[model samples]
Target: CLEPGTLPEPQLVASFLDLNAPVLARACLLLECAFFVNRCNRGEWPSWMKMNLPLPMQQAEHLTQASSQHIAISISGPAGANSDPID
Candidate 1:
């Protein structure tokens, strides 16, 4: 998790932000790193998602509740940006 007062660099490379570049936001690291998902083509997702999780299905409901509080997030896009994300 990102602690207060420790933000990343101020400027970003224009090219890197060209398309709907992926943005890493609200990263929360669970103490127990027992779960992870792989990134693959859209075609492969259906089968991959069907795989059972390490934990029981009944407790999976808790996975989505990553945060108990919310904060304002403001992102200003470039003046003239065009392009779509690769993935």
Candidate 2:
């Protein structure tokens, strides 16, 4: 999967949400997160990071946790956080 290239950006994720398509938004966000985590695992940041297997292992687990939390929050809707904005 680490095919020596630039990271892919989730171009229309915001647009998906703007159009009231949360399922699409979540899918797009998940993809973005996946790509990001994969890149981190592959250490594809040019001269910034070297490949490390341990980092890859941790990143995989973190992605699962992060994806679930983000999806759960999105499914619950914006009414909860938008109303509070602080806590």
Give me the displacement of residue 59 in model 2, in angstroms: 23
Residue 66 lDDT, candidate 2, scale 0-100: 99
The candidate scoring highest on TM-score is 2
- Per-prediction TM-score to the true structure, in the order listed: 0.15, 0.29
**Candidate 2 TM-score, C-alpha based:** 0.29
Encode model 1's per-residue lDDT on 11-85: one tens digit a residue: 432233454644541222221111222222323333434564355654665554433222111222442244566
CA lDDT of 56 in candidate 2? 72
The alpha-carbon root-mean-square deviation between model 2 and the true structure, to one decimal in Å, is: 16.3
lDDT of 2 by residue, 1-87 (tens): 434433444565445556765686578566766776787677565443344334777989999999999999887786675675566
Question: Global lDDT for candidate 1?
Answer: 0.34
Q: How far is candidate 1 from the true structure (C-alpha RMSD, Å)?
A: 22.1
Clashes (N, CA, C under 3 Å) per candidate? 0, 0
How far residue 65's Cα lies from its native spot in candidate 1, in Å, is 57
